[model samples]
Target: MLRPRKFKELETKLGHRFKDPGLLERALTHASVRGGKIARFDNERLEFIGDRVLGLAIAEILNQQYPEASEGELARRYNRLVRGEACAKVARNIGLGAHLILSESEADSGGRDKTTILADAAEALLGAVFIDVGFEKARAVVRKLWQEQSEPVPEVAVDAKSALQEWAQGQGLALPKYTVVSRKGPDHAPRFTAEVIIAGRAPAQGEGASKRIAEQAAATALLTREGEGGRLGDA
Candidate 1:
C-alpha cells in the first residue's frame, strides 16, 4: 500500500518497509499524544518490546564480532551499546527526532531532542520493525545502524580512570583533568568530591572516601556519560 511521502522517506532511511503502515506511525507516536484512534500507550508497549529486542540483537552482534573477547569484555560493550545514550545517538543519526508525534507541551519542551525520549522512540521503532518482519530483519536493521559502535574495543580493558584516559586520547583529546571539589564529614570518615574534566565538555563529579577513589569515580562517571559503560565491569 502507498504511504505518505514523509513515511516513505523514513522507510528509506530505516532500510526496511513495513507491511502495516500503522505500525510505523505508532512507533513514531509519543505517549503524550491522546485522541482520535491513537492511545497514549501504543508506543510505550512497543518501547518495552524494543528494549528486549535490542538487547538480543546487540548480544548476537557482539558474539559474532568479538569471538576472542572475554565474557566480561563483551558484557561491557553490550552495556555501552544498549544504553540510552547509544540509542539516542542512533536516533539522532537517522533524524528520528523529527518524525516523533508528541503533545504540544512535550514538543514545545524539546521532547524530540531529549535523550530519554529519543532513546525510547528509537527502541520503539526497532520494535515496529521486529513486528513488521521478524528477528532476522530486526538484527539486520540494528547491525546496519550500529556498525561503527560495534567495532572492536579500542583500549585494553583496564580500570575506569585508565580507560577514560585512553578513550580521550583515542579521540585525539588531552588527558582528563581531575579536581577536588570538596572535603567533608568527620575525621573517622572523610568524604571527598572530585570532578573530572575532558576538554570541551562539562565535568562529571564523584564522591568517595579518598581523593584517589573520588578521581576514579569521576572518571567512571565521565566514561558512562560518554556511553562506554565506563569499563568499570563489576568494580
Candidate 2:
C-alpha cells in the first residue's frame, strides 16, 4: 500500500487530487504488480486512449499554428513532437517516474528510466486526467507540459523532398531524381527500394512499401545524411 504522505506529495505534483483516489492509484499501477487491491486495472487501456487524444490535441495545435505549411511538413513536425523520446523527456521533466507502481523486476531493470515505458506512462497519465476532468482540462494539462518544448515555426523545411529540392536549387546543382533500385516480394505487396542521386555525390538508398514512399524515404535519408555531414551544400 502507498503511504498517505507519499500519495499526498504525488497529488501535489500532479496538480489535481483524485476524488476516488483509486483512479490515480490505477493510473500508476503496472501490470507486473501483483496481489494488491489497487492492481486490478493496468495502465494499458488508458495509454491507448491517451495516445489518440494526444495526437488529436497536437494535430490541432500544429494546424492552427502553421496554416501555410503543407500537410507533409506538418506531419513530420507532429511526428517529432509526439514521438516516444519527446514524451519521455516531458515525463522526466515532471518527475513522473518516481510515482510509478512497477513490479520489483521492472524497478530493478531500470524500467523507471526506460524512455518507452515513461512515454507510455505519460500518455496514460493524460488519459487519467481527461477522464477525471474533461477534454478542456486535459488540453490545458498537455499545454502546460509542452509549453517549453513548443517553438516558433522552424526555418528548416520539414518535408524531405522539399528540403532536398531547395538545397539542390540553392547550390545550382541539377535537380535531384529518384530511381527504383530494385523491387522484391509478391506483386500484390511489393517492396520498392529507391535511390536519390544528385549531380556529384554518391547516391542514398531507401526502401518502402511503394515506389513513391521509397522515393520520399530516399530523399529523407539523403537529406538527413547530407545535412548532418555538411555535404549537402557542396552537392
Candidate 3:
C-alpha cells in the first residue's frame, strides 16, 4: 500500500487529489514491475487513453488560441505540443521521473530516467486524471501543466515529415521514403532507427522510441543535412 504522503508532492503539482488513489498508483506502475499478472494493472492501458486525452486537450487549446491559423498551421503546433518529447519534457519539469514504480531490475537499469518511460508515464498520469474525474478536470490539469498559451506564436515547431514531403514536391522530386532499419531493446521499451531516402538526396537516418517518431527524426536529419533553409542535398 502506498503511504498517504507518498504522492503528496505529485498531487500538489497536479493541483488535484485523486478520489480513487489506485488510478494514480496504476499510472505510476510500469509494465516492468508487473510480475506475470493476469489482470492488466500496469500503466500501459492508462497511457493509451492518456495519449488521446492529451491530444484532445491540446487540440482544443490550439483551436481556441489559433482560430485564425490554417489547418496546416494548427497541425504543426499541435504536433509539436503533443509529441512524446514534449511529454517527457513536462515530466521532467514536474519531477515525474522520481515517482515511476519500476521493478528492481528496471530501476537498476535506469528505467526511471528513460525518455520513453517518462513520456508514457506522463500520459498515463493524465489518463488517470481523466478516469478519476472527467475531461473538463483532466483538461484543466493539462492546461496548468502545459501553461497558458499566451506566448507569441512559435515558428520552429513545424512537422518535419510534412516539411520534407512538401520540399520534395516543390523540387519536383520523388517523395521521401522512410524505412525502419532497426528496432532494438526490450518490447516494453523499444528503440527504433529509421532512414529517409529521397530520390536525389543522400540518405539520412535517425532513431526514436517508435517508428513514427524515428521517421520524423530521419526527416529532420535529412532537412538539417540539406541546409538551414532545407535546401537540396547531395545525392
Ordering by TM-score: 3, 1, 2
**Who is ahead in TM-score, 2 or 3?**
3
State which candidate has the highest lDDT: 1
In candidate 2, the residue pairs with backbone N, CA or C atoms under 3 Å apart (3 or more residues apart, or in different chains) clash, namely none
Q: Write the per-residue lDDT of candidate 2 for residues 1-235, one digit (tens) a residue.
A: 4547766876666676666577677777777775554534888777887788788888888887888987556756777678798899988988888888899999999988889889988888778878887777667777778766656556453456556766677678888888998999998999999999999867999999998789878987887877632333331
lDDT for 193 (candidate 1): 98
| Pairs with backbone N, CA or C atoms under 3 Å apart (clashes), candidate 3 | none
Q: Which prediction has the highest TM-score against the true structure?
A: 3
Write the residue-wise lDDT of candidate 3 on 1-235 in tens digits: 5646769889999988998998899999999978998436999999999999999999998888877887656656776788788898889988998898999999999998898999999999999999999899999889988874324365554567867876676678998899999999999999999999998889999999999999989998888877733432211
Listed in order, each prediction's TM-score against the native is 0.68, 0.63, 0.73
TM-score of 1: 0.68
Ranking by lDDT: 1, 3, 2
Off by over 4 Å in 2: 1-3, 34-40, 153-235
Write one digit per residue (lDDT tens) for candidate 1, span 54-165.
9999999888888887765676688789989899999999999999989899999999999999999889989989989988898889988888788776744567876787
